[model samples]
Target: MKTEDEWQHCLTPEQYDILRKKGTEAPFTGKLLHNKEKGKYICAACGMELFSSEAKFDSGTGWPSFFDANKENIATKRDLNHGMIRTEVLCKHCSSHLGHVFEDGPNPTGLRYCINSASLDFRK
Candidate 1:
């Protein structure tokens, strides 16, 4: 397992800011937003598999959006940040903030899991 300092060194300033500090990346700037590989998305913090490629889709919302996670692999907390209320999702084990969940999704769960690419590590 990587220590806090190790994670700080492994990620860039912008990546650390968003992934570690619960900040958001600039829209349409993430490389993985357009990725269509068959793989798994793991938490950058502790290497926990969160989302699969099958659940990923083009939401045209700049950031990568997923319909679901890997079978309860993520945990969520109600966020009241920025004077607004939203559900913030995190890695189940590490408690690393991934992003927020919205009710605007395609089907089934009706959840648009808007996540920052910096918070995830793709394994192909």
Candidate 2:
């Protein structure tokens, strides 16, 4: 595990704010929102594989949406912030905030993992 100082030093300001501080990137502004490449999305802080390109879909919600994730590398918990109750996703390996997951998604899993691009790095 890396110290907070180490994370700050290694990550960009946007990555630190979104991954470490649980901050959300502006909707429709994430770099991966329109990405259709075949690859895996890994945690920016820990390099843990989180999502596969096969699971990605355009949810029209402005964030990178996935129908499935690398379950072993991710975790979720109740989030009651901003006057709403939601499930917040995290990178289990490093405990970095990734984003949230919702039930309103396509068939097969019916899960929409609305993630922040700053919290992830793509590996093709």
- Going through the candidates in the order shown, the clash numbers are 0, 0
Which digits, one per residue and each the tens of the lDDT, describe model 1 over residues 32-113?
Answer: 9999999999988778899999999899999999998885789989999999999999888877789899999988889999
Error of 1 at 111 (Å): 0.7
TM-scores, in order shown? 0.91, 0.98
Off by over 4 Å in 1: 1-6
lDDT of each: 0.88, 0.94
Per-residue lDDT of candidate 2, residues 1-124 (tens digit): 8899999999999999999999999998888889899999999888999999999999988899999999999999999999999999999999999999999989999999999999988999
**Cα deviation of 85, candidate 1, in Å:** 1.1
Clashing pairs for model 1 are none
Off by over 4 Å in 2: none
